[model samples]
Target: MLTSKQRSILRSMGNELEPILIVGKGGITANTIEQLDQALSARELVKGRVLPHTEWDTRETASELAEATGADVVQVIGRNILFYRPPETGRSPRIDLSGEG
Candidate 1:
């Protein structure tokens, strides 16, 4: 679980990131989950966008994607969504959430 402070920090970091993952009218799929899993492993923080025509709303899409990829939802603004996950064992996470300056 992420603390409010951690989520805040991630939200700030997400503001500058461009959306790399896109959810379309197809909604969530196995391939989409796989891609997001790979992204989480590599980047820890990922930004995604849901097209306006999708069946699922932005918040629902974010929730499903986050659950599917085992990532935390950092924020969802408009069509953009931010996700964060710690790297697998033996790998280093890209974002630091220790709350130490």
Candidate 2:
């Protein structure tokens, strides 16, 4: 779980990242989850979106994806959602959460 400060830092980091994943008309399919898992594993901070055709709204999509991925929902703005997962054990190049209280 992220505190306000941690979430803020991640949000700013997310500002520069492009939406790596897009939940389209298919909604949250297994493929979507798989791609998201891959992206989050490669990059600790990931951004994604739900297209207008999807049945789920912004929060539901974000929350559902976060639950499935075991990643923290940093923020959801408009259609975009930011997710963060600490790198697995022995992994380097993860988000540095140490400095923020």
Candidate 3:
């Protein structure tokens, strides 16, 4: 779970990011979940896009992907969605959600 400030910080970081994942006509799949997991692991903050051909809209796609990846949905605007997940126990979190109340 993320506080509003944390989500806000992530959204700002996401503003400069290009969509790393694309949810196309295939919609959400095992492959999509795998890719999202990898992306979230590599980058604490990840942005994805939902194409017009997809059966799900941005919000649904974001919700599904976030649930699948165990990540927080930072924002969903237009066709783009942002996700955030802290690194695992031993690893340092790439994006520091600390220090900000």
Candidate 4:
């Protein structure tokens, strides 16, 4: 679980990141989850969007994506969703958050 401060830090970091994936008419699919997993593994932070025309709700889809990707929700602003996961094994996470105990 992420502390509020950690979520805040990730939000700030997310502000500068362009959405890497866009969920469209298909909603969340196996390919979408695959890309999310790859992105999270490589970058630790990932931002994605649900197109306005999509059938799925942004927040619900965000939750689904996070669970499928094994990532934590950083934030969801508008149609955008931000996800984060710690680096795997020896891979170093690029973003550091304070207030860790």
lDDT minimum window of 10 residues, candidate 2? 92-101
- What are the lDDT scores of the predictions, listed in order? 0.90, 0.89, 0.90, 0.89
For candidate 2, lDDT tens digit of each residue in 1-101?
A: 78887888899899999998998887898999999899999999999988886677989998999999999999999999999988888889568766544
Across 1-101, the per-residue lDDT of candidate 4 in tens digits comes to 99898888889889999999889999888999999999998889999999997688999999999888779988988899999999887876677776452
Candidate 3 Cα outliers beyond 4 Å, as residue runs: 99-101
TM-score, predicted candidate 4 vs. hidden true structure: 0.93
Each candidate structure's TM-score, on Cα atoms with residue i matched to residue i, is: 0.92, 0.92, 0.93, 0.93
**Candidate 4, run of 10 with poorest lDDT:** 92-101
lDDT of 1: 0.90
TM-score, cand. 2: 0.92
Residue 20 shift from truth in candidate 4, angstroms = 0.7
User: lDDT tens string, model 1, 1-101?
Assistant: 99999998888889999999999988899999999999888889999999986677999889989988889998988999999998888977678887675
Rank the models by TM-score, top first. Answer: 3, 4, 1, 2
Check candidate 4 and list the clashing pairs. none
Clashing pairs in 3: none
Backbone clashes under 3 angstroms, per model = 0, 0, 0, 0
